[model samples]
Target: MAWYMNSVEDLAELYNRVKEKNIPIERVSDHGHAIGIYIHDPDGNGIELSYEMPASEWGHDPSGYMIGGTAKGRLSGPWDEALARQAQVTA
Candidate 1:
């Protein structure tokens, strides 16, 4: 199950909350057009809490799907850093 977060700030705050609660994080994945904080539900279903890139930054595939390839060599931009860049992004 994937839940979309409204902004990087919301995602970053949740990241901090998840850490404080000591919940095991599955992974933080950067999917080019989105960033997700993944974890499992109590019933063991995989859950992705994500923030998508602005419409301007999204890419479309020739096949009609949104581009979602992960970045090569180290996933970039954990929640907090991404949140910090929101200022630049909005500017």
Candidate 2:
């Protein structure tokens, strides 16, 4: 399952809080149009916590389905709280 968050900062905060609880998180990864953290429920059901990238950065297939590439080398840490705050002010 997948859950969407508003921004990278929001996702980062959630990740930090979840981590402090000692819940096993699988990994953090980028999916082109989003960043995600993979985890499993107590029963082992897969879950993804994700933050969608801006629509301007999203790509689509010929059939109009969103097609995202892997972001294996992208950084996922040290979210710029300032940037998020700026965005909120401008938005």
Top-TM-score structure, candidate number: 1
Clashing pairs in 1: none
Which regions in candidate 2 have their CA more than 4 angstroms from the true location? Answer: 58-75, 78-91
Q: Which ten residues in a row have the lowest lDDT in candidate 2?
A: 71-80
Off by over 4 Å in 1: 59-91
- In terms of lDDT, the poorest run of 10 residues in model 1 is 68-77
lDDT of 1: 0.68
Model 2 lDDT tens row, 11-81: 88888887789787766555556676788999999999888777756656677766654433243554334
- Give per-residue lDDT, candidate 1, residue 50: 81
Every model's Cα RMSD, please? 8.7, 10.1
